[model samples]
Target: MSTGIVLHHLVDSRSQRVLWLLASPLSGEELQIPYTLKIYQRTPTKQAPPELAQVHPLGKSPVITDGDLVVAESGAIVEYLLQKYGNGRFQPPSEGLVKNIYYTHYAEGTLQNLLSNWRIYGMIGERAPWPLTYLSRIIMSKAQHAVLLPTIEASTAMVEKDLEESKTIWFAGGSEPTSADFMMLLPLEILPRAMGERIPKKIKEWVDAAHRRPAYQRALKAGGEYAYAKLLPEASEQ
Candidate 1:
């Protein structure tokens, strides 16, 4: 399918997932997929810009435009890209339960919520005001050390587990790469910096593997540094 991919970039937000997807296995100049990376600066009041509403009714970042087709929501966009451009490159064969688990179930379900909550609360907590901030921190603390962190730890416990796990040498099940890896990368990348010492070693290894990729490096250079600085302003040099 001939389609254009436009990513609405927000500093240290889920949009980074889209960048990772574009940089992964499906990416190359030859794909002829022209992608527009739109950078949306955070408002002084810490709200998404009203201009985003013009792109889609919800006015959210990480929206993508393919010709006349407009898709909002990160999961939808990633799935669309996989089905449209992926050509079974990133996805495992849809033969059994594992493929079903990886594609139909994983992206939209538990891992999705975990990643979303982890990024939102984890990254924005320090900047948010009291009560709300306190609550978010509590939830993040529990989720990370108790739930999400442990799952990742167990998943990557063995080299065989890692090898059989996903494709793209990241998260999804394949030798190459996929949007699944992209979905998990953003939050995984930021957690160690935000949580510090609390992040598990296994997860760190997973992130290290993803980070070594040339495309991930390119994406980080292209957009992540500014986003990280924006997200963690306290750590940024004054």
Candidate 2:
């Protein structure tokens, strides 16, 4: 008895994971729920376009409009889906859950933030003049090494530990994808581009498993040109 929702999606944004969630509900009519997709392309600088700001002041991707309700932020959108449509699937009850609840917060703010810093410094190094910017490049490299790279390393290790100890290919959920998988996939899928040789086996396995899901492929097909979707060889969609 919920109104149809409108997802304001960006091709390579965190919205991709939300697309997966909508395409693949763990159970019930979540998939059958009426929803529409509003696609936005990034500007030349790889940032969300100004048009998105009209939807909300912040103008970030992954915003949803359900009737008069406008929701922004990936984590909040996931929670909204779970509340309105999940029907107690893909997560545990509100109390006494660790990874399930913890990830909803950390996935966007902490994990993505670390990776963004790496990209920022890399961009700085790229734009720095080769001969004239030698000193600038050194400073940027030092800054990257001193802060961003270490943070990515530590976060990567923490995710590895969480996966290895959980004994589940997916993050918090046991043997099956959860809301955490949807939230966490954004970071893991980018490992090939973000970290390259530093990609961990456990994370690769997790992502491979996700790729194999028919729903994931369908989402990718509809979502269009996800920058990191092909990082690893994805299974052919059936």
Candidate 3:
């Protein structure tokens, strides 16, 4: 299964997005790129395993080594895989059709920001003073209620609206799923745990459709147990 493409994947990380692209139909039929998954388990703290740092400076998951060229960053890896292996399928030439590119980067930029903020905030609260821990939790919760939650609501609503307006089921409005779909999948899949009942029906429908895709399902199986697929009461508690 080694096409000289080695994917350093971590269980239940952003790495799933890259795995989706690797396991996609385009990869097998259109591009014919075979990849080997090098899985790394997260520490009890859920940080990257120490052995991973040897792969690259940060030792982050989703890092791929193509031949001698090592690549990192989920968006960058998706783009590289699409452009190099996509063979004109997902890599559209039309400059005007930028949604694919937009979504690839935007998923990390806009959507993940909300998720990362709360994760860090929650981590900080968890480590805070025994006397101040309750106060810290109250403050973070209030901030989420006042600011983060509303922003997340608007963002989810925006996606729902985009799908409603899209000519296709995906955010890119492409006839077929593109790199954008893979990029968007990770965050959206992770969102349910973060947003819970706040998730809109449109988003749920979109994720459900993506989940049903044979390629996506295959990736899920190969990617190992994805805790993020189902909405858990407290993901941070893990």
Candidate 4:
């Protein structure tokens, strides 16, 4: 059918998840939600280009236009597609639905913020003038150890425990990937490398599984040069 979907994709942004979600196959069938992809380049500073502002006032990525309707935010775009085009796919049954909903928001609402704070602290330290660089690094390191790593470690443990207890690979305890998987992928995948900590074995496996998916590979090829694309050789190694 004709899906008037136009995905405004920015390289290496959360928008990649939207592309993967759209390309994900359900019950051995394609979503067929064909759309145009308007790729925008990030500036040298890694900020989204101003052209995105034309698509949505915030000018950030992970936005889409379905005919006259404009939707932004990774979570919003995922939900919009699931509601209109999912046809009851990529969602868990009632028993798993609550977990699904929690994780869907948790990725951006909770997890990503923590990850961003860690990155910001590091950036501040790196960009500080030479005179202050040493002091800045010490301060940032202290802040990370004091304020961020504890929470981050606890959150990761919580997820690992949940996955272990349920004996389910995906977070929502479903056989196939769900919206929760789509949302959680980036944060979990980036966690170990981003934080320089070894993620729990189960979480590492989950990330590897996600990367090995056909749809995810397709998304990488279509989206172009994702920083988080499965590391060389195999994602399993990382």
Task: Report the lDDT of model 4 for residue 89.
Answer: 82
Single out the weakest 10-residue window by summed lDDT for candidate 1: 229-238
Better of 2 and 3 by lDDT: 2
| Candidate closer to the true structure by TM-score (higher is better), 1 or 4 | 4
How well is each residue in 63-147 modelled by candidate 3, as lDDT tens digits?
A: 9999888899998898888778777776533542677667777799888878777677777766788999999888877776676
- Best-to-worst order by TM-score is 4, 3, 2, 1
Tens digits of per-residue lDDT for model 2, 1-238: 2467888898888899988888775422545777888899999998999989988789899898888889998888998888888866676434326787777688888888777766787778778776847777778778877887777788889888888877567677465666778888888877555577677767777888888888798789889779787776632222
- What is the per-residue lDDT of model 1 for residues 1-238, given as tens digits with 9 covering 90 to 100? 3356777776556677677777664666646566767788777865778888888999887888887888887778888888888766666444332553453444446544555565565666555677688876776677666766665444334323544554434444455555556666655555544354555445555666666677776777666434442332332222
Residue 167 displacement in candidate 4 (angstroms): 4.4
Q: Which candidate gets the maximum TM-score versus the true structure? A: 4
For all candidates, what are the clash counts? 8, 0, 0, 0
Model 1 regions more than 4 Å off: 1-3, 93-100, 103-108, 111-168, 193-195, 224-238
- In model 4, which residue pairs have backbone atoms overlapping below 3 Å? none
lDDT comparison, 1 vs 3, better candidate: 3
TM-score of 2: 0.88
Between candidates 3 and 4, name the one with more favorable TM-score. Answer: 4
Q: How well does model 1 score by local distance difference test?
A: 0.61
> 161 in model 1: Cα distance from truth in Å?
6.4
Question: lDDT, candidate 3, residue 62?
Answer: 80
Decoy 1 TM-score against native:
0.68
